[model samples]
Target: MKSAHSSWETPDPGYWTKQGYIIVRTDERGSGQSPGLLDTMSRGTSEAFFDVVEWCSEQPWSTGKVGLLGISYFAGTQWRVAARKPKGLAAIIPWEGMSDYYRDRVRHGGILSDRFIDFWWKNGVQPNQYGMPGRAARKWGRDTIEGDLDKATLEQNRRNQTLDTVTHKFRDEDYYKTRDYSPEDITTPLLSVANWGGILLHLRGNVLGWMRASSEHKFLHFIVGRHDLPFYYAHCARLQRSFFDCFLKGNDEDGWKSGKQPRVKLCLREGDAGVDDPERELLFPHREEIDWPIPDTTYTKYYLTAEQQLSTTSQSNVTSFAYDAMEGKPLCFTHKTSARLEITGHIVAHLTVSASRSKADASPPSDIDLFVTLRKLDQSGNEVYFTGTMGDPVPITKGWLRMSLRKTNATNPGHHKYLPYRDYFSTDVEKIAENEHYEVDVEIWPTNVVLESGQSLVFEVAGHDTQGVGKFSHEHPEDRKPEDFAGINSIHIGGNHSFITLPVIARG
Candidate 1:
């Protein structure tokens, strides 16, 4: 019953209420009207969610069938509860919810994301903690109900929430796994909605849930827009209604029957503005498919060459570049295609990298942090940046990896010839030998992009993300500092060590 939607947001429940559906919204423990401390995604919250769903079904006004739906936090709880398989829970629409807390939130690609989490904690969740007077009370009157928790309880809740994310920076640890749930554990019918711009938190989870979930009725739709915008978008709302009606209300007219609904629907970003102007001036050209890693996908390898070029043919020459972890220049490779191309799936790059301590510094970094970004350039060689999750102009897709955690998971089913999965578990850590080359594979998230003829594809390898530029100033708090990265880094190309595999969708 806990609601992450603001009290002032009428459209969420308003849409359901108008459809003759009852909406039950409650505050979870330690927030708003709840009394206990906020434990974030702890097991306690999952149990409370299960209890509330069952309680709601028992009510006289209920039809004894319950379905879960929401965006972000509201959507996240559905994953946890569905895994528990609450009795009355019939269907779930986990719109933009992250399934793995470690991979999706605290540590992304084994790098701590302290900036976004800190910002989210201070600006997003703190204000809604139990002790603060409710927004309703402030807007309504002094007689209105204040939050249930006292001042002491609220402070303790804040401390606990902070420790949950900041304390543990490793993945698959007891702290993170205890609060995490596998998609395979969920048996309920699911409709996952993903946003391409939700790189900071939502996108990965949605895709992972769809790909890993064991549900036979699972459906995934990739939309073009900001994280929260798509949840209320008219098209998305209608689709959600159809899915719920088919599952929760036993209505077959909703167009969600097996063999009827496409397993994946991609909302391709078209036009110059990209997904920035979702309200207007942008078109969401959609493509439907029965599965992802799309069947018949043509995997093409683009080898990294010596002359700062990407070519289809492999090269034996080696290339190296020196970068000052914090401020060094990045190595870039460009490919100008003669024919138009459309890329619509996962991309993986393999590179041979090595690092050495800067002579000026007594101590050097034991491991290297690499940030890989794929960008596009127009015919005139101008960078083509798109509006991404942070509402700023960013490259198409970005990948990150800490060299020490680059061990591949041999047992992961998702790993194959073209696609390799990096295991972020603590056991996978293998320290890098100073100045010894190590082959590492970095996986960029799935994306749909159309490259016109004469346009060029650009790839950049850097020690840190570019910042201070116009519309690209955002930085993550967990970015490795200059002192920690006082070293010279090199990227080796040639032989079997350097190449990128791209899923090139065949065009008629």
Candidate 2:
């Protein structure tokens, strides 16, 4: 479903016809010329998707096989349609579409991306900003639910609601019922292209979908740049054609399926870092041995020293940093410069901390999100940056923790290290040991950066928002400061609990 202003435009139905393929660009239920309430994909929206695909298959110009294209919302409907398994459906090229709607859309690292989605709906999808040209009138459409079911205006719409009203139910029934997809029931072939630096709503879902989907033939590709950058121009279109040609038209799998099976892929060295240069070519794609969590990685822990040091030793009950709210100092952790090192994986911080308040207002048994950034500085003290197709600097890997969502005590010691404390929500935050040290695991986001030996690796522990990385932005123009951001809490760092774990890749 192309938005009114989205550059989701195609090269005309003639292009597909020339290739002996038929293309049908119908206004999905409520949006364009179609008559229906503008309910944003409630239960009715999923049904509408099924109807659209089925309708296209029944057309005389069609060959009874339907495949989906486009990005963002274009890839979104695939979740619902694929889950239903329409017989006429062939394969899907879901460009950056992840299966878990909740994780990709609303929340990450247990923190609600309070600004991004609502902002996108208000500006991008609903209003079609960014100067992209389109003809669909940008207006607030109707709701499919709560309206006359048999009338022409509401018939096409399946639900009468928008995401703005249903933000409260991440773990509840409202959004879950409509947004959730049954990965087990979807067996169709899929080609999911993800963007490494897609801060808004990319990367994570692509990784999860490629791993979780029941589809036997699934290919995962990663590009670099802004979330929607790949959709514009001809690059994304050419790749989409290759995908549909192989799956929809029964063409030979030449470009679509070829070469070194890359499970985890990255678009190579891209973008200008801390320097001004005319942005280079649009994109560069790279492949990896494993899909998620990176492959062939040697996971090593970098211990924190009491005297503000980073070491590869287990100096038990040693490292600690003072993290007071008003006078907290930013601690620096560094390793000896070696050869050039490229660290590409997730970095986790396993810390035991104590707070000044026995019952702190800010550090409640709630899942509190803290920001962790991995940076590199050259010998001359210059910060290095990376850019790719999307024309944006990318972060390696990121993680989250809910103060109350933490789970530390597992009977199995082997599994204790890999416990579910990463971001899985737990209800009992109040029961954790009070006025004492408790384990706090801060997960850094995934990243792909190259650092030289003479240079240093820096990890920063911050409580408020840092604009350089993920989508959680306090200064986002559309975002009004929410209640959570206003709260303040102080972290106590001591010998028993506070250190950053680094996965150091030895320099060659």
lDDT scores in order? 0.73, 0.55
Candidate 1 contains a number of clashing pairs equal to 0
Per-residue lDDT of model 1, residues 295-341, tens digit only: 98998989888888889898877667667776788888988978877
Candidate 1 ranges beyond 4 A from true positions:
1-11, 133-152, 279-282, 417-419, 467-483
166-248 per-residue lDDT for model 2 (tens digits): 44433444555565666667788788877656544656666656666788667777665555555554655666677678778
Report clash pairs, candidate 1: none
Error of 1 at 177 (Å): 2.1
Top candidate on lDDT is 1
TM-scores of the models, in the given order?
0.91, 0.76
Q: Give the C-alpha lDDT of model 2.
A: 0.55
* lDDT over C-alpha atoms for residue 101 of model 1: 76
Worst lDDT 10-window in candidate 1: 467-476
Give candidate 1's TM-score.
0.91
